[model samples]
Target: MPTQPKVIFFDVNETLLDLQPVKESVANALNGRKELVPLWFTTLLQYSLVATVGDRYADFGDIGAATLRMVAEKNHITLSQEAAEAALKPIRSLPPHPEVPAALRRLQRAGFRLFTLTNGGSAALQDQIGHAGLEPYFENLLSVESIGKFKPHRDVYNWAADEVGASPKDCLLVAAHGWDVAGAAWAGMQTAFIARPGQALYPLAGPTTYTCEDLSSLADRLVD
Candidate 1:
């Protein structure tokens, strides 16, 4: 394993916050077809990368709404952007995962600097963290909005490291998403993959420094 990093940057959605509530809200909007939530989410991620590659910058929420509309259209359902945004409203107030608070405490007590890095807009990110009462656990919240590019883009990772005044190798990215982990790993940062439900590593990506089932397990391994 790589030595412990000086700064540990976390991916907010799904990694720290439980997305079940948001999923439920989306399910309601999709006429109870809850199975489609994953597809919508994956499409959101895919198009965020598309936006990045196409030199277009849009808020994560906007991309989410657009993807939801696409998903709706594909299924012969109609969804307006405004309505889709309303459905995704739960995202701003998502609760942290059950083990998240305690795991963060453990990591803080172990003297590692913690911060959040996300593709979500800064205003919405602040609301999410504040609503979840996770503000005190992080030193700062970083957003790709400022960079105009999304995760899995090498530039975003590099910019994040520079923004925090840390060498890429001295930073550790903690995320549940395969693409996020891959991006950070390729950018020369250490990575810890939190295997949240339905999450998996990209088979083609290089190995991560650590892989654990949850934040608590990751904390245990980190502080051991």
Candidate 2:
């Protein structure tokens, strides 16, 4: 029999929340060049990793703005401060995936403690949760700010497990990113990979103990 988790820590972007609209917004802002969105996102992740390795940190919004400007410049596009700001405007208003609310509600009702661990800063995360009507579902919001690191950094996962007062073995890390799962698994937590479309698992060793197509399916597994 599978052991039930004492706490479940979720990844925000791409897991519970859909980032497609934000990508589209950035693409539109970049004058129909959709490729810029991925470029910016990759840069954002790269900088976050650099911060983690260098023992430095910047808020997600700042990183997003900086990366957008860099990407714009690289593409020979003139990016004003206003335009960079506009590119990130959709971050706060991203809609939750259709299955998120129901899955969260079901998990809450089933007596599982829920928390969020995201790369997003406190303000951005708060705005997103409020906008998505998901604030009521999570017991706590754990940001990378607290750990001065990003996902795939073992310390962040350790911090989350510690904050919830659960041993890593008793908690589950749920995310759409295989790197995140790999990190959490290495940190001793069980992992659930949400096979969200457009994301792929890394061909690496990790504790990807379970897989689900959506939050609802994951919730069903947990409750069962």
Candidate 3:
């Protein structure tokens, strides 16, 4: 029989909430340069990692607004700071993906402690789950702000396990991002990769304990 995790750590962004709506926001902010949506997002994540490596800490939301301004400037799109902030505001209200609510409840019912660890800060994460009406399902919401680093950093994963009084080996990280799964696996935690559309597992990462099409699929494996 397979071992069950004592705790499950979820990733908040694309893993739980649908980011597709933000794509439209980005496209609009870029002056109809819809194609820059992906690039803008990539830049945001890249800069977040940069801060982590430089021994500096910045909230993901701050970095997001900054990066949006940078992306606009780079493309000579003439975006204003106000417009960028407005564009990013939609994140606060993003809905959970179709399968997320049921999947989370399933995991919760399985005798596992469920929590979130994200690059997003506490206030942002709380507001997000609250907006999606998901706060009830999660026992706690964690953020990387404490360590001043983002996900995929080994310390972040270990910190999460330590914070909740769980051993790394007994925790399973479920995320849509390959890099997050890779980091958790490297830290000796179990991992489930949610293959959300264009997202793919990293070829060089350690094998995932579960690879499913969505959160529901992974919950199915864990619940029954």
lDDT of each: 0.93, 0.89, 0.91
Predicted candidate 1 versus true structure: per-residue lDDT over 1-224, tens digit per residue: 67879999999999999999989988888988998999999999999989999999999999999999999989988787888999999999999999999999999999999999999999999999999898998989999998999998999889999998999999999999999999999999999999998999999998999999999999999898
Give residue 102's lDDT in candidate 2 (0 to 100): 93
Q: lDDT tens digits, residues 127-178, model 2? A: 9999999999999988998777888899899989999999999999999988
The runs of at least 3 residues in candidate 1 whose Cα sits more than 4 Å from the true structure, single-residue gaps closed, are: none
> Model 3's lDDT to the true fold?
0.91
Ranking by lDDT: 1, 3, 2
Q: On a 0 to 100 scale, what is the lDDT of residue 35 in model 3? A: 87
Ranking by TM-score: 1, 3, 2
Q: Is candidate 2 or candidate 3 better by lDDT?
A: 3
Can you write out model 3's per-residue Cα lDDT over 67-168, one digit (the tens) per residue? 999989998989888898899988988999999999999888888899998899888888899999999898889999888899899999999999999999
Q: Say which prediction, candidate 1 or candidate 3, comes out ahead on lDDT.
A: 1
Clashes of each: 0, 0, 0
